[model samples]
Target: MRSKPFLTVAHRLAILAYIVVALFPLFWLLKVSVTPNDLLYSEGVRMWPSRATFEHYTFVIAHSAFPTFFKNSLIVAGSTAVAVTILASLAGYALSRFRFRAKYWIVALMLVTQMFPLVMLVAPIFKMLSPLGLTNSLTGLVIVYTAFNVPFATFLMQSFFDGIPRDLEEAAMIDGATQFVAFRQIILPLTLPGIAATLGFVFTAAWSELLFALMLISGNDAATFPVGLLTFVSKFSVDFGQMMAAGILALIPACLFFLLIQRYLVQGLTAGAVKG
Candidate 1:
């Protein structure tokens, strides 16, 4: 049944309100990033100041170490995303398709791993990494982030694989394709949406991670953007302008990443793989 026009308008208004509420912080971030420093405090709660400037953007890019942080963050997040998605895709396919001994126990163990608070494990992790020379290194952060993100990504991919039918692979195998070939040629293609989603999810998680990056990285050289944001805080005052500018700049990679993947991110990758 078609809804009444008044009800449709009310529903749209409600949704618009929620969107505004959700995006208000981002709007504010953009606003502050452009607001002139002189007007920053003097404006005292105005949405749009009388004038705006790109001074913060210029300063952050040209004068600050934000570029280094950006590059480091890109490396860490990209590595983590790629590594986690690869491991998760393979593991998820196995979990979804193959039957094996102790499967339940293995999944249970993975679930148990996810249950522990990360902070509780930080000390142990630090001690473990220190002796291995993994501490204070970008590789160490990638390892840690990959480890943390894999279980969740595995589950995410498993859901997608589960939605796909086994018949396609079975038919491919019957037609003389090897299991690996069938998986690569047939199943993987249908899983693009899931892969894109997993990549985006893992990338964002590693990008914004602060606690582990802070504790593990001692120098600015290896610091991710989130950890580097702390540099804006001096003993005297916080440079909100440069910090917000950096934050805005930091969003570029993730936004670009999503833009690249969004075509594949459309849901229902398995739509035509199986009969409805």
Candidate 2:
């Protein structure tokens, strides 16, 4: 009994430590954002600032192009996440339910695509998109992001589909429902966790993507938040406060996205446990 209590305490402490370690950077970013510029360096590693202000945030919102960047990022990431999830759901369902001669080769080809460094393909992708007038366009970024994310998202959804029992869909079909109806009304509801996970994964990827955005987008109007953040850097100095403020603001959509999906994620996990 004593040993069990000690183990429980140890587990709690370990989790607490991990949480602190993981969140310290974000905490620091928030800390710095609120800290006054004069006291930033002078504070010398204090956990909180003696004086805090919202001036940085105010400046970013009122005087900067951050709002535009935020809008562009929301549009790109939201569209890409929705597109990938839809495609991934269909592809994942097909892969999970069907046995075809080409399935192995198809999976292998996707795995091969992941094996190559993205940098190697950037030039070729650019060359291809340039001819189609997709360069520097949000549509181009969405296309690129969707293509890159769909394969992994498909695999994610497939694993979820595999976890569901075939008998569930079989029973639904026996009631005169079509396969598509069975999938839509029965199988999909059960795979909510997988769908939520895929959406969050793709959204986070599209939200933080920088390299492709930088390489393909040339002007400020089309810039996503990650690329927009670069505007804070100059040869002589960096705007640490404004940058941190923007970072915090950028975190809002992602935080809200996860919050919205978290309930479904939990329900999915619980359902899986019960099924198991």
Candidate 3:
């Protein structure tokens, strides 16, 4: 009995330590963002600054082009997540339910795509998109993001589908429902957690993407928030306070998105545990 109690305390302490390690950077970002410019360097190594101000946040919102960048990121990430989830759901259902000659090859091809470094394909992708007038457009970003995210999303959804029993769909079909109807009505509802997980994954990936956005987009008009953050750095000096403020702002959407889907994520985990 004493050993069991000690083990429980150790487990809790381990989890608390991990949480603090994971969140320390974000806490620092918040700390620096609020720190006044004069005190930034002077108060070095302090957990909190002597004085704090919202000027940095105000400047980022009003003086910078962050609003346009925010809008562009929202559009691109939202579109990519929706597109990837829809396509992945269909593909995942097929993979989970059917056995086809080409299925092995198809999965192999997707795995192979993931093997290559993205930097190697950047040139070829740029050449292909340039001719189609997609070089500096949000549509181009959405298309690329969707393509990159769908394969992984499909695999994720497939795992969730595999966890579900085939008997449910079979029962629905016995009641004169078509496979599509069974999938749409019965299977899908059970996979809410998986779907929410996929959406959050793709959205977070698309939102933080910087390399492709920087390479494909040329000007401020089409730039996403990741690229827009670079505007704070000039040849002479970098604006640490404003940059940190923008970083905090960039975190808001992702945090809210996860918060919105957190219940489903938890439900999915609980359901999986029960099923297992």
User: What tens-digit string does per-residue lDDT give for candidate 1 at 135-186?
Assistant: 9999999999999999889999999888878899999999999998999999
Backbone collision count in every prediction? 0, 0, 0
State in Å the error of residue 112, model 1. 0.8
Best by TM-score: 1
Q: Alpha-carbon error at 61 in model 1, in Å?
A: 0.6
Q: In angstroms, give how far residue 141 of model 3 lies from its true place.
A: 0.5
Q: For residues 36-105, could you state the per-residue lDDT of candidate 3 as single tens digits?
A: 9999988769998888899999999999999999999999999999999999999999999999999999
- Candidate 1: which stretches are off by over 4 Å? none
The residue-by-residue lDDT of candidate 2 on 1-276, one tens digit each, is: 356988899999999999999999999999999999999889798999999999999999999999999999999999999999999999999999999999999999888878878999899999999999999999999999999998999999999999998988899899989999999999998899999999999999999999999999999999999999998887898989999999999999999999999998877442543344
Per-prediction TM-score, please?
0.97, 0.94, 0.95
| Candidate 3 off by > 4 Å | 1-9, 268-276
Residue 54 of model 3 has an lDDT of 96
Cα-based RMSD of candidate 3: 2.2
Model 3: clashing residue pairs? none
> Total backbone clashes of model 1?
0
Shift in Å, residue 33, candidate 3: 0.3
